[model samples]
Target: MRKGKLYLIPTVIAEETQAVVIPPHILQALPGIQYFLAEDIRTARRYLSSLKVYESIEPLIFEVLNKNTKADQLKKFFEPVFQGNDLGILSESGCPGVADPGSLAVKFAHEHDIQVVPLVGPSSILLALMASGMNGQRFAFHGYLPIDGKDASAIVKTLEKESRSKNQTQIFIETPYRNNTLMAVLMKSLADDTQLCIAVDVTGKDESIRSYSVKKWKSIPVTFPKSPAIFLFLSH
Candidate 1:
């Protein structure tokens, strides 16, 4: 029997922007997918509803695969796919396997030779990078920096130094609630001439993307609203 393909479906980063961010091809493929491995079942269901691909969501099967999902349980999520039913892997936000736990399932699929397909959609990291006016050819995305004050500050300085020497862009994110604190640390830790780009609420109606020197940032009284954001910087 032929094995079913594992689709890495990308979803909108922000809420209420499906029509703007998700491609038509992804929506058109939804009606045929009955089994899904999602980071959050409720969020996944809501996204499917937004697509309106099916008359009803009752027949859809969703299995959780968040940070808490264990290695032992990963194999089970692919059983339906092995039985000749294609499975969709949905992340809580953006594309699956990009800083999301959905990578675990994709890695498993590869080990077992299951065909994998990735559908394009909004990715805050890429969107932010594109708008940052920084080094796009050579950039590194450090998912999230350390939460501890001293540690975070130290890492920020190290990244800045690396950026200066290599002409590379460093990108990172923080929890929404801790965004301001991270911003403050970044402004204080980086050199005056180092360029900083803060991309906030990407793809949302209130989207904002700006780049400035650390000195300029310190001169301005900026506040980061409690929302998803991506921060990038280049020391050169």
Candidate 2:
């Protein structure tokens, strides 16, 4: 029998210091896990430390890497798991793959015939969509846009068009620091009547969700500081 299962652990609110605190009970249970794949070593350590399970853990060995981790890194990451170890994939924020590093591992597992199990928790994308009052029946999450201003704008426009045509909810994320610039560009590119939803600091103390027409939205100050956010645009 396989010794372990692959768990897509949701960082959900783990990355937001102001959001739900990852419980020690969960971390303690994780020690029994075969391995852990985290987005960032520093943030993973912080989570362990926060749970006070850092030093007490003996069985739970973890490997730290980010979304940009390559095929080589992925192969090495699952070597032990493939050899009969259960692994847990964690994100810096919300959930793994929702916008984190774990898809490659999942794809690799499927290709290698490894059993995959997803652990339930927070997902900003879903949360935002549910609250957006838009067409949730057929929605698309575009993850994060490119850092290059032009590339990002192109993707946004394409997503906007898709949303308009399919009545889809085009969800995209941006770096916190550059969020304002992205939002500004977003409003500029989209039509004045386009509906937009701003979900920032989800599942956190400062969590907020508000939707408005593009023209109306731009009139208000959308300064949410440097916080984790997901931006959604829905078509009429």
Candidate 3:
């Protein structure tokens, strides 16, 4: 039996900006896919609606594949594809398999020799790096830093030192609600001369991407109010 392919679909990071962020070709591909493994079904459905891709979303089969999903449970998600039906892996935001649980499905697909296709879309990590004026060639995305204050601060200092010695751009993110707290810790922990880039609300109307030294950041009073953001670090 001919096995089906898995499309790694990219969803917009922000709401109501589907037309501006998602490509038309990706939208056109949605109709042909009958099954999808998404981190959040509601968000995925809303995204598809924003693009007007599907006349009705009731027929689509969406399987939950978030952080809570277990490894053993992943097998069921591939059942449709095993039956020769193409499937899509959709993340809550950005491309799948990057800082998202969808990677587990992609890993399974690879193990079973299933064809995988990744569509183009906006990634806040890449977008932030592009706008930060940092070393794009040598950069590391560390996902999220520790939530504990002491542990998170230590990791911040370590990354800063690594950035200086290796000349590598360090990138990481924080949960939306903790954005301000993380920002505070970063300013307090990093060296005065170290450069920090805060990319806030990428692909959204209130988008802000600014790179400043720790001293400058200290001088300026800023607040990140529960918005998605990416932080980049480069030390001289």
Return the candidate ranking by lDDT, descending: 1, 3, 2
Q: State the lDDT of candidate 3 residue by residue for 1-236, as single tens digits.
A: 89999999998887778778888789777789989999888988877777777878889899999999988997888999889999999988999998888889989999999999999998999999999999999999999999999999999999999999999999999999999999989988999999999999999988999999989999998888688999998998
Query: Which scores higher on TM-score, 2 or 3?
Result: 3
The better-scoring model by TM-score among 1 and 3 is 1
Tens-digit lDDT track for model 2 on 104-196? 888888877888877666787888888988888998887678888788878878888888888888888878898888887887788888899
Root-mean-square deviation (CA) per prediction:
0.9, 2.9, 1.1
Clashing pairs in 2: 12-94
Q: Which stretches in model 2 have alpha-carbon errors above 4 Å?
A: 14-29, 52-55, 73-75, 148-151
lDDT of 1 at 54: 95
What TM-score does candidate 3 reach?
0.97
Writing each residue's lDDT as its tens digit, candidate 1 over 98-168 gives: 98999899889999999999998889999999999999999999989998988999999999999999999
Provide TM-scores for the models: 0.98, 0.84, 0.97
- Candidate 3 least-lDDT 10 residues: 46-55
